[model samples]
Target: MGHFKLLDVFAGCGGMTRGFLDDGEFVSVGAVEVDRSAAATYAANFDPTGGHTFAGDIADYTNVPRADLVIGGPPCQGFSALGKRDPEDVRNQLWREFVRVVRESDARMFVFENVDRFAKTPEFELLRTAASNGGELADFRTQVFRLNAADFGTPQKRIRTIIIGSRIGPVVEPPVTHAKNPIGDVLRWVSLRDAFLAGPVVLEPGVRDEWFPESTADFQNFQVPGPFKLRDLHVTRRYDLTSEIRYAHIAPGKSRLQLPVELQYPCWRKNPAGASDVLGRLRWDQPAVTIRTEFFKPEKGRFLHPQWENGGEQVNRALTHAEAAVVQGFDERHVWHGTKAEIARQIGNAVPPPLARAVAGVVADRLQAG
Candidate 1:
C-alpha cells in the first residue's frame, strides 16, 4: 500500500506523528506548532532542514498542502480539571482551526486528541454536532473514544478523549493489548519497576548521550541509545532533610494521609480526604499515574521514586525527567529541545507514542479500506 502523507497541527514535539512514523505507515508532509521550542524539538529529530515545519499560529495556515490525513488538536487546557474551565477562554474554540485544517487539506481522515473533560465541554458538543451535519465535517463519520494509555501498553495511565473522523468509513477504538486484568493473550499493564528500576541511574549528568547504531532495549516501552544520564536523567530537585523525612513517612503507594498529625501539614490534616495522591510515593509494582508538566516537584503528585521508606538505597528523589519521558512512551531516539522547564512541558503535553501507534493502526485500516 502507498504510504499516507500526514499533517500534524498543534504538534507537540511530534509525539503523535512519531508514533505514526514508527508504525511504518505514514510520513509527515507538514507540521504546525506554535511553540518555538517545541517546534525546534520536533525539527531536531524529524525536520532538520526547517522545511515542512511551521512554527507559527495555525490561523495563518491558508492553502494547506493536501495530505492523506491530519492529526492533533489544540490541547484542552481550558477544559482540564486543573484549569479554571473558563467559558471565555479563547483556547476552547481553537478546535475550529482543527476543523478548518481537515476541510481545507481535504484529508480523508483526522484524529483529534484532548483531555477527558473536553468531552463534557460545550465546545466538544459543538464539534460533535458539526461533524454529524451542517458543517465542514459533514462528509466524515466521527466517533469518540475514551482511551487510557495503560490500556495500549504505556506505563502511565493517561486517559484522553480521542475523536476520529473518516470520510471513508466508521472508526473503531483501537484494541487494548495490555490490561490490568489480563484475559487470555492480553498482557498485564507494564509496571514502573519493569520500566524504570533495572538501569543504573546517574544522580548527575553523563558526558554525552550515547546513540547506538540500532535500537536496544533499556525499557520495554522506550529504548534509548544509552542509559539515563544528565540532560533529564540528572534533572533532580534538592528537597531538604525536613521534606525528606516527610517523603520517608509515606510508604510505597501511600500518601500524606499516612503522616502522623504532628508530621502532617495543617492543610493535609484538615482535608485528609482531599488530594489523596498529593505528596504520594509511587508504587514500584503498578503503572504510574499521569505525569504532569511539573513532575519534577514531588509535592504536586505521586512522583517520588520508589525508595525503601524504611531501609535500602536512598531512592528518596522524585521521578527524574528520563524516567518520566520513558513512562510517556518516548523512546531514547526521541530528541527534545528547550530549557529544563520547556522540555518538561513538551514531555508532559505529549501523547504517548505507544498509544498513538495503536491509533495509527486503526487509521491505516480505515484509509486502506477507503
Candidate 2:
C-alpha cells in the first residue's frame, strides 16, 4: 500500500491520530483543536517533535496541508442526546466547517464523527445540503453507522455515530470482530490489571489541602479502618455515593444465574435525574460504562470506584486519569500531558483509538484494492 497522509480536526489528544498512525499506512500531518489545554495536550503527544498546531478557531482557518484522508469529530455537545436538545445551538453549526475543509482538500476520503443524536438533528439536513453542494454528490458517497465500542472489542459499552465519505464508490462498514460479552466478562477478560497495578499513590498536594488536611484532628474525622471493604461502609458519609447496587448472581466460572445482588449501596435510587447519579458498582468481570469527561466528577455520572462504600470514610475517588485512558483502549505507555482535569476532558471527548483503527483499516484496504 502507498503511504497515506491524514489531517485530524477537533482532534482531542490525538486519539484518532494515534489509531491511524498505528496502522503503518497513514501518517498524521496536522490537527486542529480549540481548547487551549486540550490543544496543548494533543500537540505534546502527537507533534512532540514540533509540528503545526492550530490553537485558534477552525472556522477562521483556511490553509491546511492536503492529505489522502481528513478525519475529525466535531464537538457534539450541542447535539448530544444528554443535554438540552436545542436545534438552534450555535455549536451544532461547527459541522459545516468540517464539511467545508474536507470538500476543499485534496483528500479522497473523510470521516466525520458525532453523537448518534446528530443523525436526527436539523444540522444533519444541513450536512446533507453541504455535501450536495460541496461536490460529494457528484464525486463522493457517504454513509452513516451507529457503532458501539463493545462491538469492536473495547471493554467499554459506548455507542457513537461514524459518518464516512469517500470519492471512490460506496464506503463499506467494518464488521464486528468481537462478540458482545456482558459487563462482567469484559472486565475479567483483559490484561489491564498488571498494566495498572497500583502505582505510587501520589495525592496531589493541592488536592490534599482542598479535600483533606494535614492536621490530625481534621484528618481524624475522615479516617476509617485500613483496607475496609466497600460493603462495610455506610452510605450517609459519602456525598458522592450512588444508591444503585449490583449483586453478583453468578460467580466467576459459574453460570450467570448463580450471580445475585449480594449487597445494596445506599444512594441507589436517591438521584432520579441520570443513570450514573444513582448508587452503582462495577462488576469485576464486565466492561466499564462509557468513560465521560465527567468521570472525575462523580456527580456528573456513575463513575464510582468499583470498591467505594456508601457511608465509608475512606477516600473512594473517581477513576484516575491513567485508569480512564486504559479503559478507553489507549496503551498504558501512551503519555498524557496535562492536569488530571485537562486529561480527563481529552479522554472524555476523544474517539476511542480502537474504533478509529478499524475505520482506518477499512480505508487502507479500499485504497490498496483501488
Candidate 3:
C-alpha cells in the first residue's frame, strides 16, 4: 500500500501528528492551528520540511490537502465542564467545519479528539447530522471511545473522547495498553529519570526568579512531606486568579486548605498552609495530575515541582519546557521552539505523544489488514 497521508486540524504543537508520523505508515501532509506562536512552534518541530502549516482558524479553511487520514481535536472549551458548558456555544459549530473538510478531502479515515462531555452535548447530535449530510453515513462507519491517557502508558490520568470514522470498514477502538497504577507507581514505572538524566539541561533563565537551582538538594528529591507543620516557601504568580503572592508552601500529605479560613488563599495547592502551588515539588512514585496550559504559572493547577518543601528554599521552580515535554511523553530529543508562553501552551494542549502512538498503531494495523 502507498504511504498514508494525514492532515491535523487544530494541531496544537503537532502532538497528534507526531503520533501518526511515528507509526512509519503515515506522513503528515498538513496542519491547521490558530495560535501564531503555537503554529510557529509546530512548524519548527514537525514541518521542518516547510510544506504545510495552516496558521489560521479551521473554520476559515475552504481547501485542505487530500490525504488518506484526517485527525484533529477541535478546541472544545465551549463544551468543557470547566468552561461555560453551553451547548449552543458558537464553537460547537466548528465540528461542522471538521466534517466539511473530511468530506471535501480524499481522506478515507478520520480521528477526532475532544473532552468527554462532547458526547453528552447537543453538539454531538449536530456532528451526527453533519456527518450524515456529508454522506459519511453512506460510506463511513463511526465509533466513539472514552480513553484515559493512563491506559495508554501516560502517567497522567486524563479522560478524553476519541471519535474514529472509516470509509472502508468499521472503526474499532484501540485496546488499552497500561493498567491502572497508583499515582506513585505511575511515576516510578517509566524510564523518565533516565531520559531526564541523559538530556541536556535546557533551563530558561530570568523568567521566574523563584526557580530552585538545579544543584539544590531539594531539586533531587521528589517526596511529599509527611504530616508536618507548613511554612511559606516563596512568592510567584497564580494563573486562575492572576495574582502574585507567595507561590510555595509546605503541607501535610495531600490535604489542602487546612489553614484557618482567614489565612487561606484561593490557590490550587492542597494543604493551603504547607504545599506550594505551581512550582511545588512533585512527589516521586506518583503519576502527575493532568497537565494544563497553566502549568507555567506557579499557582495554576497541581503543577508543583516534585522537590518543593514548605518553608524550605524554593528549588526547581516550575517545570522546564523540556521537562514538561517529557512528562507529556515526548522524547527529550524532540526539539520545540517558541517563547515560554508559546511552548507552555503547546505542552499543555498536546495529546500525550505516547497515547497518540498507541492509537495510531491500532489504526495502522487495521489499515494494513486490508
TM-score for model 2? 0.72
Off by over 4 Å in 1: 80-89, 198-232
Compute the lDDT of residue 123 as modeled in candidate 3: 64
Model 1 alpha-carbon miss at residue 251, Å: 0.9
Q: In angstroms, how far off is 325's CA in candidate 1?
A: 0.4
- Listed in order, each prediction's TM-score against the native is 0.87, 0.72, 0.74
lDDT of 1 at 80: 35
lDDT comparing candidate 1 with the true structure: 0.77
How accurate locally, in lDDT, is each candidate? 0.77, 0.60, 0.62
lDDT of 1 by residue, 1-370 (tens): 2389999999988889888888888988888988877777776667767678887889887858899999996876644344344655566557778888898898999998888887887777767877887876888878899999999888898999988988898867799999999998899998887776543332332213222123222222223233222334445666789888888788888887788787888876677788888888888788899999988788889988765635665566677777788778876677666666777788889999999999999999888888
Candidate 3 lands at a TM-score of: 0.74
lDDT of 2: 0.60
* True lDDT of residue 103, candidate 2: 64
lDDT at position 249, candidate 1: 81
Stretch of 10 with least lDDT, candidate 2 = 228-237
